[model samples]
Target: MNTDAALAALAALAHPTRLEAFRLLVQHEPEGLSTGQLVAASGLTQSTFSTHLAVLAKAGMVKSEKRGRQFIQRAEIDALKGLMLFLAKDCCQGRAELCEPLLAELACC
Candidate 1:
């Protein structure tokens, strides 16, 4: 991805609450979570969670779908992988094994 997109994604995840919400959504993958679930999980207020969700959606890190009366927010995994690649594109002069553990976690999500 381009530098600006990367910066926006990183910025969207920079905050503690936002990062936690994003990570939770990432971990949940396609299933995602409702606003109330995210609010409880992040311990954030409704307005705060809405703001963070908007930021993430604008960054293309997440997408929201309405299911009945509630909205389900899900992480865009491909976009998240792009962010990870941007951050790790240049790492370890040699011995990529040093970063293997970090990369290994990618498979978990």
Candidate 2:
């Protein structure tokens, strides 16, 4: 991710509602969540949820699909990972070993 992308992602997640919605989408993974379901889960009104979703979609933090009358939203895990990678891309200027722990943490998958 570039600086702009990272900033957008951070801005999208800056709101509490959007943060929780993204977490819900992440937990649901590929299955995602429909508009009504997201509203129910988040305890937000439809209008409120839509605004948050719009911000996330604009920032590339969320993906949405039309399923009949409902819009299903999914967390953009790759984009989020890219942002994290971009932030740490430089690592230690002269000490590669300093990043061993950070790299090790991502070894889970």
Candidate 3:
């Protein structure tokens, strides 16, 4: 992701509801979850959650597919990876040692 996209993704995740929604979607993985399921999990109204989903979608952190009559939302893991790489690149610039520990910790997760 470029700086703009990284910024957008960071901004989108900065909110509690959006962050929770993205994490929930990530847990679901490739199967994803329907819009109704997401709203129910969020304990928010459909309209309210839709707005949050839109932000995530706009940031490329969430992807939606039309499944039957509803939409299935999936977390864009690649986008997250790109953001992490972007941040790590700056921190590990000409210093691979600094990033080794961080990479090791992330591997556990």
lDDT assessment of candidate 2 = 0.89
Model 2, TM vs. native: 0.86
Model 1 C-alpha lDDT per residue in residues 33-85, reported as the tens digit of each score: 99899999888789978998899999999999999999999999999888778
Expressed as tens digits, the lDDT of each residue in 2-71 for candidate 2 is 8888999999999999999998998999989988888998898899889999999999999988988878
Per-model TM-score on C-alpha atoms:
0.83, 0.86, 0.94
Residue ranges of candidate 1 with Cα displaced over 4 Å = 92-109
Model 3: per-residue Cα lDDT over 1-59, one tens digit each: 78898899999999999999999999999899999999999999999999999999999
Point out where model 3 deviates above 4 Å.
Answer: none
Please tell me which model should have the higher TM-score, number 2 or number 3.
Answer: 3
State the displacement of the C-alpha of residue 28, model 3, in Å, after optimal TM-score superposition. 0.9
Top model number, TM-score: 3
The TM-score obtained by model 1 is 0.83
Give lDDT: candidate 3, residue 87: 80
